[model samples]
Target: MTLLPEFITENGEHIRLMLVDYFPRLVTAIVILIVGIYAIRVIKRIVQKIMVQRQFEPTLSKFLADIMIWALRILLFVVFISKLGVETSAFVAILGAGGLAIGLSLQGSMSNFAGGMLIIVFKPFRVGDTIEAQGVIGTVSEIQIFVTKLTTGNNQTIFIPNGALSNNTIINYSMAGTRRADLLFAVAYDADLKRTKEIIQSVLTSNNKVLKNPEPAVVVNDLTDNSVRLAIRPWATNADYGTMVSEVLESIKLELMQAGIETQPFVKESSKK
Candidate 1:
């Protein structure tokens, strides 16, 4: 009983001595950790504000901000562990090994991450731009870290993976401030070419959306045996492209009909196919 009491008393004294020696360091580490967290938050906010002001991509900005916060937090953790007398090099080594294992296991995720980074850096297209890729045509709604969102003309939502998107051919239709609307209309072979051109020119000139500087082009695209193919090309801003095309097409059809211009009838020839 006496031996037990003596052992307990000695151990208690040793623990008290250790606490007295370590208490200041523990307190200091905690205080530093708290301050460091606040600093990191402030820094993150500043970075976000800068990104917003610079008109950076929202996804890229958020992703970079998160990375910055994590890096700072990791550094603060290392400092805290050092204050607690833990071996930081060993901890870092362990983290590296674990990260390698995770990286190998999630290889696809890493590829997507890399693809997303490449997209952000290269800037193939931006949100609100109309792009055709992977057999889908739509306007870009968002560029996320792992995927890109598209809103189609019919209001369909599409999610494309970043890796596949980066690898495939992306046709951006809105890169040019103005888009050329190419329209083809088939008229009867006997129709007067001069009168047809005049009517088409009238229709194009009256439309405000069509750019007058480049001048509208109405030319013979092809000489089909059954009909005369007229190609109509007009330049309009991206926003007005769809509406202007519809209007031009409708006006041409109505004007041609009113002038008694005949449309080519279906004449299936054996050599046509």
Candidate 2:
């Protein structure tokens, strides 16, 4: 019984010593964790505001904010653990190894993620922009973290991986705000070339959609064995390009027919001969 009391007294003294040494550290760790969390929230809000003010893409902005938040949280956790008198070097090494393994396992996805980051940062194209890349021509509908969605003219949806898209050539038609319509018309070899050119030019110039500054051009592009190919090039706003081409072709055909100009390929005329 005397030995039992002595043992209890020794344990109580050891417990008191441990509490004296670690209680402050525990309180400090908790305080750091709480403060770190609050700071992270404030930083996130500030970053979001800055991105908004800079007109950053919504998808990119949110993605970047999340990345920053998680990175800060990891650092805070490390600090909290260290403050509690726990060794962190081994923990950090393990994290590094795990990250490497994950990265190696998802090499392709990581490449895509990096590509997406580049795209979001540089902004070669944006949503609603008409772009031709990876052999697909369509308007960008959405830009996600790993893939970009495009909507074709026929309402088809295409999802292109950001990795390939970033590396490939991207032709942005809508960026120029204007597009040139290249139309070809074949006329009989016997037809008056000068008169045909004048008719085509008139049809283009009469259209309100055609831009006046560049001036519509009607040139003899090629002389084939049977017919003369006339190239009519016109500049029009992107919005008017399709409609202008249709209207111009119809007008040119009607005008040439009224003038008795034959549009039949010379093969027919040669056959008749």
Candidate 3:
């Protein structure tokens, strides 16, 4: 069969197109897209594996992995769209607008994310630790994206927003291996200072849970108008602090009472330091 002349323009340009032009291009594009998606998935898996293998602090690792995945996907999408000869400037403009809207809506969440990053980097405390923050005392249960979870001594679970945590003062009691337990008592002027000191020492010494290295201390700190002020200080492990201190104080009061050493009344009487 004889072929007809190609379509010609007045400018002396001619065009001859293949019958498979549109379909072949479409198929090629589909294949590329498929391969690209597969690559992205593979990369994501690799990232996840690396993060897991490193055993990074879970909260921090997850955050980093998420950022990696997001950046990868966005870049891939942009590249694919550009391959189709699409106007990327318009795409970016639209994305910018959408991102702005989303950001406005999620400002608080983003603040929390920033806070979480700060916390992970600084490492003021970790999960399962005891801390006092924002005037709340609790054991850290979990550190998450938006908030930190804490379980109080009373078994009450509380969720503190990460931003607030980052801003507030945090006291990590667990960070210190030993904590001082300070107790005060008053005695009458007639009470023997020597006997009182001995009693306090006996009480702290009997508490085996208290740390021995610091050597529990007892001293006559002050003498008030009503009674002689005495101080008892002991060192105990952070874990056993509350129970040990409470028990020691209770024991001393009871022991002194049993020894016929009545607590000096807070009456208007002179005290001997």
Q: Report the poorest 10 consecutive residues by lDDT, candidate 1.
A: 264-273
Q: Write the per-residue lDDT of candidate 2 for residues 1-273, one digit (tens) a residue.
A: 699888878798887899999999999999999999999999999999999997777987899999999999999999999999999999999999999999999999988888888887888988988889998888899889899999998899999999999998988888888888777789999999899888888888889999997888988778888889887888888788778877888898899999999996321111000
Q: Flag the better candidate by lDDT, 1 or 3.
A: 1
Score candidate 3 by TM-score against the native. Answer: 0.78
Give the distance in Å from residue 273's predicted Cα in candidate 3 to where it truly belongs.
30
TM-score for every candidate vs. truth?
0.88, 0.89, 0.78
Q: State the lDDT of candidate 3 residue by residue for 1-273, as single tens digits.
A: 223333234323322354344456557667777887798789878988886785556877877877887877787788767666667998889989999999999999999988887787788988888888877889998999889999998899999999999988988888877778777777777777788789878888888987889898888778887778777778888888888877887887788787767676532213110
Scored by lDDT, model 2 comes in at 0.87
Give residue 216's error in model 2 in angstroms: 1.6
TM-score order of candidates, top first: 2, 1, 3
Per-residue lDDT, model 2, residue 107, is: 95
Stretches of candidate 1 exceeding 4 Å from the true structure: 1-8, 11-17, 265-273
Which order, best to worst by lDDT?
2, 1, 3
**Which stretches of model 2 miss by more than 4 angstroms?**
1-10, 265-273
RMSD of each: 4.3, 5.3, 6.6
